[model samples]
Target: MGAAITRAQIVEVADRLFYEQGFEATSFADIAAAVRLSRGNFYYHFRTKDDLLGAVIALRLANTEAMLDGWEGATPDPVERIRSFVRILIMNRARIMLYGCPVGTLCDELSKLRHVAKDDAAKLFMLFRRWLSLQFAALGREADADALALHALMRSQGIATLATAFQDEGFIQREVEDLLAWVEAQRPHQDRPTSETRPQP
Candidate 1:
């Protein structure tokens, strides 16, 4: 494989390991072994675990931006777009149940360790917060857009954390449905569309 491809593979594996095993618990050798690279070769791609972590955070930020963009492009309705964000709990339920939100868990771990990249990891949540705030603003709640956005983010993190602790699939489903309903209800009464006029995401 080319050097760039090798580096991408290393970052990809490290991202998964960091999410599943955690940042502090996963060592450089563990990631190198998973990527089938020699320690020497791995060091060529990432001299230290922190270097690998920076790459992983970058990858996550890029991927999240792309996802939010896709949702934005998929629908013109802000309510439907916001629904896409809330529905992620249902979409990624299994993994969330297994390991918790990737961004939340990573930020929590890095915070506990006082890792320099804790703020970097938090940018992932910030990314979502900003995106959600825009969606709320588009729906006409400009004054409280950021607060509403943070509320949504807080709810998602809470649901994910509890789901992982309880390992309750039904609880996830129920909470997601309630969250979806809450998102839909946020649409201004004047802006709400009839069932026949509603846009499908």
Candidate 2:
């Protein structure tokens, strides 16, 4: 395989390892073993552990962009788009419970270690913040767009932290329901989408 392909493979596995085993805990050997790449080959692509971190952060940022874009295409209503964000906790509840939100945990780890790529990992959160702010702006809450977006982000981070700490899926479900209610409340009466139970305009 070409160098580019090998590098991509290493980053992909490193992303997962960092999320699961933690960035500081995951060794080059662990990543190499996972990809079945020889140490020499792995070293050829990533000279230092931080080099692997840089690639992993870039990979995560690209994936986050694609995911946020997918949600944008999934619906026209900004409220529903925001709902999609809330739904991520439900979708990844298992992993969130284990790893306490991949992006959040990584940023925390790198921050503690004073890793150079800390801000890069933080870009993952930045992507969500910007996307959520746009959706709130579309909802005509421009004044509170950033506040609203950050509110949702904070709630999710809190939930992920609690779920991971307590290992409670029930708490996740309850919090998700509450977050969805908050999203529903943000929609204006005229632009609100109706379900079967709700009266149509």
Q: What clash count goes with each model?
A: 0, 0
Kindly report which residue pairs in candidate 1 clash with one another: none
Kindly list the per-residue Cα lDDT of model 2 for residues 1-201, writing each as its tens digit.
888988888899999999999988999999999999999988988999988888888888898899999999989889889999999899999999888899899999999999878888888999999999999999998999999999999999999999999999999999999888888877767666565234322
lDDT of 1 at 130: 95
In model 2, how large is the Cα lDDT of residue 159?
93
Q: Worst ten-residue run, lDDT, model 2?
A: 192-201
Per-residue accuracy of model 1 over 1-201 as CA lDDT, tens digit each: 999999999999999999999888999989989999999999998888899899999999999999999999999999899999989999999999999999999999999999999999999999999999999999998998999999999999999999999999999899988788778777877766575343322
Q: Which ten residues in a row have the lowest lDDT in candidate 1?
A: 192-201
The residue-level lDDT of candidate 2 at 59 comes to 84
Best by TM-score: 1
Alpha-carbon error at 80 in model 1, in Å? 0.7
Candidate 2 local accuracy as lDDT?
A: 0.90
Each candidate structure's TM-score, on Cα atoms with residue i matched to residue i, is: 0.95, 0.93
